[model samples]
Target: MQRNPISRRAEAIHPSAVAEMLAMGRKMEAEGIKVYRLVQGEPDFDVPENIREAAKRALDEGYTHYTPNQGMPILREAVADKLERVNRIKAKPESEIIITNGGTLGLYLAVMATVDPGDEVIVLAPYFGPYANMVSLAGGILVEIPMVKSGSHYSPDLDRLSEAVSPRTKVIMINTPSNPSGSVMTRAELLAIGEMACRHDLYIIADEVYERMVFDGHEHVSIASLSEEIKERTITVNSFSKTYAMTGMRLGYNVANPSITKAMSKIYQVSARCAAASTQIAGIEALRGPQTEVERMISRYAERRLMAYKRLSRIKGLHCCMPEGTFYYWLDMTSFGMNSWEIAKYILSEAHVLVTPGSYFGGAGDGFVRLSFATSEENLLAGIDALGDALSRLQPTSGRS
Candidate 1:
């Protein structure tokens, strides 16, 4: 018998469902079928021209070398400034920030630095799919506290959250303006979670990548900004990917106290060293450049949001609430009497639309699917119409819709 060489840690981590769906869509397109892609978390917009120009100038200036492990000094200063102005969090550019290759790496570093073997990390259910795998890789146990869903909105329950905390709990991971669900954490919710963290003496890992895309007059709150004590316990990670359409540029940063920043830097130095020098220069421009393009993009997303809400409303068996933030609609497909993967597979085959299976997010998402409106208006109209048509053929077992 041949011996297996895969490490248990590597085996435990699953491939990202978003990536898997995108790959399947491409394979179908290769075989001559039109695949409507609504599965990825990436924005379909191009990088702003000014930011692109900055990168080009950096390359010409011979910035193709390794930067300090923390990142370029100018970019760090910009991030510090932005955190103060936009996020209301004060971070020292010199000691409290570290530039990461991307938001994903920044999140991984936070988990690696804080979680010890057997330490428990609490997270909200129906979370970003990668969070579980990150905790697994860090040898930390993941404890989920499901959010309370009322009609079209989701909120955290303070009583339930308090019940979930254990003596072994070391961290609470949070995402505001969340992906897939498009629910932005309210200021009141952040205050409650911050208070809980302070009481339990837990580290808070906050992901605020979708900060700029909030809508419906919803405010995005940085959990660290709730109080001075909360700020000391929080590790806030953000990226230029969604805001500036710089996903491919791979630039992100984290803000924490000097002690936590040092621990994350130890892993970052050996693993990634630093983000690309040219990319870091581009990030400086993204933060300091015009707000016109960013605002325009948000306006476009608002238009698409209305379109998606109207279309989803007309579908008989699917129930979805209008997203308050981000570019996704989380649809409850339980009426179809199918699991999330089954619903996703059926839609892909019948309507040629690729959507993310909600079960991939967590067990609480088993009967749902996430549809993204980050593509062109033409795609949104055609894809949702096709999805409604496909779902209409089935006789739903439940009357929830």
Candidate 2:
């Protein structure tokens, strides 16, 4: 039998490790084995009651029809107000915002709208794995700039990042409260990156999906809010998934200047059409509703973060830095002799704990692994203990022991 040729674009992409491991863990659960899922960055909290009820109200009000390609006008207005009040970024609802199916798709639209064939997109290394695929889909080249690790912190190296930029560089993408590594870019770090983008005349694609998940006195600052010039050149993407535990809702949006938003709307209309109508209503409530639910969730995540980071750091052969934001622990396993992929598989099979191998993120991620703490306290304690035991039995790298 002959198989048809698939597109080179499709061939360039690989299945995401997070989704793949989540599936495998679920399969193990189906088989009656207790598998602790630590690979995916899904929040375990339930959606806030006000937001949930808003969706039901939308349905009851017969809001089931298709929404505007840009988004429901009301939601766009709500988002605009929230951006000004919360993020301190001014955006006109009519021309500067486009609602997306999710933050992931919003990133795709940003790339699709701005990236031309052979254009270079600079993504910070050890990034969320899907950014490469998103850039590839736009017929663009991906240029990775690995963040420099300084003791317990992961910080962007502006000089090196600027050096990586060339005439071919069209855009620079960054994530705050970053996925996989859980690093939150400081205001100083962001200003440096923003300066680089300005110097290079490159567009800025900012992903702040984990904006509300910051911990340990770290503040989440949207780069677009730094200045009017950068704001004009920036496209800010955010989601309700991580913040509100509304992953299934698929409600997210992007903010940019009018021309870019128009370009994104054209592609968005052809692809997603619009975020679910009811979901948009829910998003409106998420922005406008009371903050008690969000505050409660944040308090709980803070407790989990402290526990997970402390336990993971205590492992004999593993070294993990405390994440500034998000619920992921980035564990360095270079001493274990095995690369991230091999070690991840060993941990899953031996410890029954699922994790995302760092190499799946980038070459810089080769000896690292990412584990999510978005689970119960009991699971976090049990899973990290199992991981410690598994690592202790593995032989050290040559010359180490």
Candidate 3:
């Protein structure tokens, strides 16, 4: 069989697991089968009234033209102000920041600006699935460091991480209130990581997209906020998606040293041109406008996290850990002696519930599954009930219990 040659970078990537599962779930729904899908991290909430109204008003005033290649000055100023007030990151809007289409593009820009072919990017494992693809697409080697479990909580094996660094290591990419594991790195842990990166002369890509999606007793401290030295080496990316339920708005930004920011902006000018003008205005309202709606959304997610934890804990032989932040539950299905994708398949076939296989995150997650609590309470309850019932009927191959 003959086929067209594809670039090695593109050929190395796999289709997104979440997107694939969602498509399958939708197909089932079209066939009149009710599938309780907990596979996505997408917020099922409405965009706040103010943000929507702001976008509409911008359109009314004829804001359809392309914004500056870097970004609309007004929005960048607002973002810089919000970072100062909220994240404690002080950067000049003109030289240190550039607006992006979303966190996806923001991450890509950061990786492209610094990484070169054969350079290494250290990724904390059980990471968001796309991190691998992004690094590969940027022609960099992806290094994986799996977290150690400490009494249901996950923490980085700092010694192991330090051992992974090499002369080729260029970046240490991280996500707090992480996507698949939902483990929020403590302040002390973050400090230690910062020190390690400094000693290794590695750049930091801090993915703080879920900064506001935290639970009680869990605080999100941006690593770049630690010190001037660390801040200088860090590229911090964030978006209006999860916090404001404005995923469709396609507004995200990154702040870094002017050198890196300039490189990213040059790429943007040749690629996306600029973020949509009206969306940038909506982003302004998202940051500077009222935050009560943000608080309400966080409160709701906290409640849903509790509901999922309680239900998952009840399943026999299935170890469930409560997430401190984010809306995911990383379930340990290793007792059944099956890989994550196999377990996911079993549950979908027998239980009619959909979840992301942890292996999608990384090889370290082979025996785990990630379920989202980002759905409605009604759907959540049903999915949890089904999951519990299905797992209870199976016994661990190890026969330890």
lDDT for 380 (candidate 2): 85
Model 1 per-residue lDDT tens digits across residues 99-177:
9989999999999999998999998887888999999999999998888887666888789889989999999999888
Off by over 4 Å in 3: 1-3, 399-401
Instruction: List CA RMSD, all candidates.
Output: 1.1, 1.5, 1.5
Candidate 2 lDDT over residue span 74-171, tens digit each: 99999999999889999999999999989999999999999999999998988989888888988999999889999777888788897899889999
Across 1-401, the per-residue lDDT of candidate 3 in tens digits comes to 75989788888998988887788778888898899989988899999999999999999999999988888999999999999988899999999999999999999999999999999999998898998998998889999999998875689999999999999999999999898888899989888999999999999999999999877688999999999988989999998888998888898999999999999998888878899999999999998999999999899999998887787887877888888788899988899999988899888877889999889999988988999988999999999999888887788876433
Candidate 2 lDDT at 113 equals 94
Positional deviation of residue 325's Cα in model 3 after best superposition, in angstroms: 0.6
Top TM-score hit: 1
- In model 2, what lDDT does residue 146 have? 88
Ranking by TM-score: 1, 3, 2
Q: The CA-based lDDT of model 1 is what?
A: 0.92
**Model 2 residue 307 lDDT score:** 87
Superior candidate under TM-score, 1 versus 2: 1
Scored by lDDT, the top model is 1
TM-score of each: 0.98, 0.97, 0.97
